[model samples]
Target: MDGVKKISLVIPCYNEEKNITRTLDGILEVFKSSSILAKYDFEVIAVDDGSKDATWAQIVEYAKKDNHIHGVRLMGNFGQSCGYQAGFDASTGEYVITVSADLEIPLENLAKVVELLEQGYDFVNTNRKNRWGGEKKAKSGMANKIISRVSGVCMQDRGSGMKGFSRVLVDNLKFYGDMHRFIPDYLTVYRAKMTEFDVEFKDRDFGVSAYKGSQVFWFYRSSYYRLWFLGNCVSYCAKTVGVQYWG
Candidate 1:
């Protein structure tokens, strides 16, 4: 353990009872096989976003079996970003990353993410070339493009959930509402040493997508987030550069 580093995996699961165990095993398969990754001791923080199913029970069971596993149960159904907020607050690792319990992105892709992080990138966000379902791809695509244009961040897949952050970034950033999706834009303001990596997209094997009908105002929502990002930047600059007394 002397040479090992602690890494935390924050997973936000909602009604993913059927996919809980598989998600854990998939992660195990990645680190178990790699000699480099073997030195990175991993802990799983599975946040139950008030799942109506037995997802919380499954998390509790897994935590009992593995000392590295933990379960966080929210009072009610908060959004995904809120779930991540809970997990982030509870995480105790030098490096933190997130993946869905439904296995949307291949767990194996995490190895590369770990490598990038170890190389000293404060933030690494993935660009998924192919997504599972693009039912609302047109609107989603427009949103991504708009964000990239306004934020001065060239991100192809801004909404890709495959992201990793150094503990320093985790402590400084807070997730709320759907702000997690705009992490890349905020990174520009934070001036974090960041990288963009490509990862393959995989479809979930169990349960349906929770975001099925949430894209009606996708354009409008992204506009609001864009404004939010601008507002935050103005506020951060003011706090840092204003009211300095020159003697």
Candidate 2:
């Protein structure tokens, strides 16, 4: 491999047949124009989480044409965490990233993530640069702030979908239920090195968003304390139980 690192982007799709191919092309274009990211090879792992549409068929067609593309299909609707788990299980790269299949966040901002990883950060996250001035956006923003404060993982956007993780971090972490939404907070349990930045958000031109807006926060609100407690336990055990140290 000539010492070159590989980055795998994991995108979870739920009825995103219209957007999947375009999303992959956008990432490829961003990589080609990026001098910083050119040194590394990249692969895409697209998981079709029981889409009623032809999402899986689109993934299969693209994969046949591009060797870097890998597709996995679930027998039934299993939510985002499970979709991500499927992708993670199939990934074979030094760095793994989770991105929205609808391209809500610009793919070009990926250069920032690669730079941060190269500089020694084990995880990287990005928040939208501007607020869209809507009731739902305001509500989700407020809700995320509360969620982050309660978990002591306060970043600008804890629920941000696009994030990067080192292979080491990915190996040590697992997602269950809708816990993927709280990855940054949970990473604190493993004591992973992390960083965050702002990436411009774009209006979707394809079908409407798959997410349920601010209501999406409801999936993990009850689990916030559970995660907080788990993080504390890890820290406590590190001092007394001589537990495995992730840092």
Write one digit per residue (lDDT tens) for candidate 1, span 1-247.
6667889999888899999889987777777887767788888888888789998888888788877788888778878777777788778888999888888788878888888999999998888766734556666666677777777777777666678999998887766656676778777767888888878877788999766324633643545545455446424311111111100
**How many steric overlaps are in each model, in order?**
0, 0
Cα lDDT of model 2 overall? Answer: 0.77
Error of 1 at 29 (Å): 2.5
**Candidate 2 off by > 4 Å:** 217-223, 229-247
Candidate 1 yields a Cα-based lDDT of: 0.76
In candidate 2, what are the lDDT values of residues 35-153, reduced to their tens digit?
98788898889988888998888888888888878888877788887787778877889999888898889888888888898889999999886645677677667767767787677
Number of the top-ranking candidate, with TM-score as the measure:
2
Clash list (residue pairs), candidate 1: none
The runs of at least 3 residues in candidate 1 whose Cα sits more than 4 Å from the true structure, single-residue gaps closed, are: 132-135, 212-222, 225-247
